[model samples]
Target: MSGPGTAAALWSALGSLPLAHLVPTGLGPWGDGMARLMLQPLDLLLLVALVLLAVQNGRSWSDRLALVLPLSWLVGGLGGLLVGRELHLALLCAALVTAVGVLAALEPALRLGKRFLRGGTAALSLLFGLVAGSSLAGHGGALQALLGEAVAIAVVTALLLMALDPPHPRWLALGLRLIGSWIAASGLLMLGWLSRQPL
Candidate 1:
């Protein structure tokens, strides 16, 4: 039972378990990376929250988000790949997501200036991207998966920017805030779960 065959079997069994954040489809690493956006959707939620926050403020510089967010993310992710390990920062990440959600939900009241919003967006994106990259580092085709995820993020961000441009109608504005609250609630649930599970 303790032979090499048994060890190999144990390793295979461990690999089969869904412990990591990355979900693999049969469509290779790139596809897995792209699918990771939906399968593991914190990235998407953050992107949405950021977009909502940006559009609500109606700053001319908001246009830069389409470029700024993804580039910072890619750079952070590359740094993560170089580190080559996962960070056990579930609680911190959950808290950050919750805070961002709150910020998006309370955008009108907050009225953060252009400089703060721009800087905050880049910093948050970079941190999240680093976490994502760290998660993928231990997997096969990590670089490809990271690239695929980055591409997906860029496309989604661009599309969101296009759809949710400034001067939103009343209903659309309320809907964005509502979605932000939901994301915040989801983050809270995540925090509660992490508190109990400690991972």
Candidate 2:
């Protein structure tokens, strides 16, 4: 088990690491990447929570999400691809999303500042991107997938921010909090499900 045998075994193990599959969209790699976000939606949930948090804080934060979020995600995804391994962070990520969701749900009461929102958005986006990139690392057209996801993120973030602009009415404000609560609950469910799996 020493020398070349061990080396070969180790190499084989690394080579066989599971690659994340893209849901086929009949649109090649790029389309598959775009479809991945909707099909696998933890990232979307986080994005929604962040947007809600931003809207609660100020318009400036919302605007920054459109720029900072996707860019940070892309950068982190690229780094993950370079690493070429799927991250086993589902549980941790679920916890993080849950925490963020709670923050969003309580945003009005907490009244977080603009700087906090900006930093939080960037950090979360990057971390999620890294996980996503790692998942896609060994797949064919990984770069295309990353780009597609990034574009989708940008488009979605912009549309959401536009639709949920500041000066929210009482009803819309309540709606945001409700959505945040749902995101948190979803994360908790995911955490429970993942935790139950046999390691």
Candidate 3:
């Protein structure tokens, strides 16, 4: 890799969960801002990829497990934005892990009869509920902060669900692409906003 490619690779790695989770704790103010912006694109990209993977692998338990990867990212990203650390949003992470494990454990049911997938469905539902609950509770009584976090989380989560569950496959894919593109654009806007913020 060279030039922008190298820079992009390094940034992407830095923004991954292990490193990104540590940034705010380890660095000063500027590092925190850089970490947030650097990770946004990765979340957006994974959102797009997971949507496509779910559609391609449709109705399979493996597809459901693939779905958890994006769910985890969405939870972690919004959780980080809202609460600023993985520890504050540990519930969300736990829910995601449970959902993924449930999906894996139910794979045989999906292949052989589909009864086992019920447990996975319940796990996912519970995860969703936990994520919603934590998000609402995270803002500590400020209306503006509460609304902003709720809207961001809902938009990202809804976009993922819609992408994975479009009634018409053709229109679904196209719609998800547009939504994912919009998310990428929004992330860019956030970067600009962060840059211009008073320090």
Best by TM-score: 2
Candidate 3: regions farther than 4 A off: 1-53, 61-163
Which tens-of-lDDT digit does each residue in 20-138 have in candidate 2?
57777777678888888888778889988888898888776677789998999999999999888888888888999999999988988998878777777888888999999998887
CA-lDDT, candidates in order: 0.82, 0.85, 0.40
> In candidate 3, what are the lDDT values of residues 130-153, reduced to their tens digit?
343343333332222223333443
Model 2 misplaced stretches (Cα beyond 4 Å): 1-20
Better of 1 and 3 by TM-score: 1
lDDT score at residue 72, model 1, on the 0-100 scale: 89
Off by over 4 Å in 1: 1-21
For residues 39-121, write the lDDT of model 1, one tens digit per residue. 76667778888888888888476688888988889888888887789877778878888998998888888888888989989
Error of 3 at 121 (Å): 18
lDDT of 1: 0.82
Best by lDDT: 2
Score residue 76 of candidate 3 by CA lDDT: 38
lDDT of 1 at 37: 84
Q: What TM-score against the true fold does each predicted structure earn?
A: 0.85, 0.87, 0.30
Model 1: pairs clashing at backbone N, Cα or C within 3 Å: none
